[model samples]
Target: MIDEHRQDLAAEYALDALDPESARAFEAMLANDAELKALADDLRETAAALALDAPAHLPPPELRERILSRIRAEAEAGAPAAPTATAVAPSTEAPVPSGGGRNLLPWALAAGFAITTAALWMERGSLQQDRTALLQEARELRNRDFLAKVKIATLSAQVDAYSKATAVIVWDAEKQHGVVKLNNVPPAGAGKDYQLWVIDPKYPAPVNGGLVPVNAEGIARVSFSPDQPISKADKFAISLEPAGGVPKATGPIVLLGGN
Candidate 1:
């Protein structure tokens, strides 16, 4: 048996009054459960009371005869006909009139027309809601695409920075080798030539790679390996040094890289 909560939900579904998500869930339940379908059918019969009585204005005489003939034909064929206009009785209430002194027939027709127009208006509102949801989804997709492009641009900039810095020095981690690829470094005459220092921020002191001439350009690769692993270095720098390389750097840093 369907649970009490589910039966109530089925009743609401039969009335066509459930919210969208809840309606979809109930429809799925009805599709799979025969018992739920029967319960929904019963509730539908009950709610048909809203449509029980036709309006006071009768349909034209010929239209009424044609309707009755179709009903009689269905009865003779021994097939159960779907419910027809006969299921509803005519309303006896006198029609209310508008201020223009016209017969109530015109006003009743106008009111019925207005009701149909209102139903169409409600349908249009649902269509607009669907359109709004689609627009929001499109905006989200555009934002995602823009963010992806931004990420690509940022990565490209980082790659360009790495390339520019690599042009200044050629360091090979696998061979523990360092090479000076540039010549004529700045600040040449200040009692110091460019000296490479492989420093690890995790270590106490910088390891001397070698002293390099300011104008020399033929790959001044160093023989020294870094004291700590290269991965642990928070900073790397070239310092100005005297003719012979210093055991410890006492000069100003010329270039540096770090977080």
Candidate 2:
């Protein structure tokens, strides 16, 4: 049996009213709980139908009169009978208007409409916020997808000494920069650092990308901008060089990629 708390969670999930963490938790539960999933699906369908399928129609003109008449009849039926004997003193109370009860209908309708309009206005603001957030999230995803598509190269170990190393160079020619990621590569020897190079066909030699440092876990990620403009990055390479880096690669190239 789904408890009241779970039912409320399901309702909020259906309405997209839950916060991110709570929504994720509820979705995790739904994956394993068939009954909860079914209940959530039903609530979603019901909520959608109420929002989209309900027709807008005003109450009939006679509806207000009927309601007022019923209220008056009930009030009169509940009142005690008037005293049989008449007293001598005249009353001090103000006279009641003859149409006093009839006047209540307009005021009642006005109050009801005011409350309904305020509620609808609040709902409209909340929906607008949700739409803005969703649009932003979509834009971020699109940017990431575009970046993924432009990845120009993936490099692997070129020498048996660095056989376990894996590297990738994600270049963005438009921005004149790229990111290099290395995994399972051994740390550089003492007083030596790993250097990166970009072989541009226009240059006589490779352009010094930068020094790379690997953590104990053999993983390194560096954002690099080459010293020279690369008309075409024909190939990328990583080599062992003295501390800092070298303008020219004197050590063996351990990792290489591209034609």
Candidate 3:
């Protein structure tokens, strides 16, 4: 029988924050548990619909002031913090990366937050339309935060290195995932592919970043999310390589720029 602790994981699971072993355990349980599966599916659906919600509502006034006051009161009282959460019982699976896998728990939690918020406002004497307006505001806040967490870096063509080019890269350093947009690049013909490289103080050698296929319109766009973490990009460079990328840089460099 799954306990409340396990139930609480529904939100984390939906957010893909479950530990690997825990994730596997949850997945196994999910496969055999009809109710759990339904719950996960519902979360996924709600999260997907967040974008369609109405405009965001402004947060309650004085919320910040009240929070700060609490903090001050805690300091004055010299409150001792509770110990960190205890270790979870041993799990059946191995640990996995934070960003890995797709779990619907987070969406469920988001939906719950929105629904509960609306219910609260209604109980506080808000009308149906007002509650809906509140939900939209909450959606907008979540969407903004989600977007802000994603890191993006842009690079322009290095002088004397490329005829004409510009690039935009969106990367999640923690997740080691990113997409590269090499715009106005020279056409890469058959048997040739464009390779990207990462330069960071952490790695003496440049990381063998992913490759991009150039389109007829002179653009190469590719998305990558490596399992291993990549340091802050000191420099992003592009080079020509064979259909399959090489382990090291060997061909002529096409474009280069620093972060």
Q: Write model 3 residue lDDT over 24-118, tens digit each, in one string.
A: 89899888887556545544433333323325555566654554555456554864555587888887899764542344478557655755565
lDDT per residue as tens, model 2, 132-171: 8866764465345533333334455777867766565656
Error of 1 at 218 (Å): 12
Off by over 4 Å in 1: 1-167, 216-233
Candidate 2 lowest-lDDT run of ten: 49-58
- Candidate 1, pairs of clashing residues: none
Ranking by lDDT: 2, 3, 1
| lDDT at residue 54 of model 1 (Cα atoms) | 17
Q: Which ten residues in a row have the lowest lDDT in candidate 3?
A: 45-54
lDDT of 1 by residue, 1-259 (tens): 3454775576456545577899998889889987567557545543342223213333344644454455446545864455454564556987666455575578668755765565556456655776688667644653454222211000001222222222123234434544433322343465657676766665678777677664433222233355445644344566767867688888876655422
TM-score of each: 0.30, 0.47, 0.43
Q: Which candidate wins on TM-score?
A: 2
Which candidate model has the greater TM-score, 2 or 3? 2
Q: Clash totals for all models, in order?
A: 0, 0, 8
Whole-model Cα lDDT of every candidate shown, in order: 0.50, 0.70, 0.61
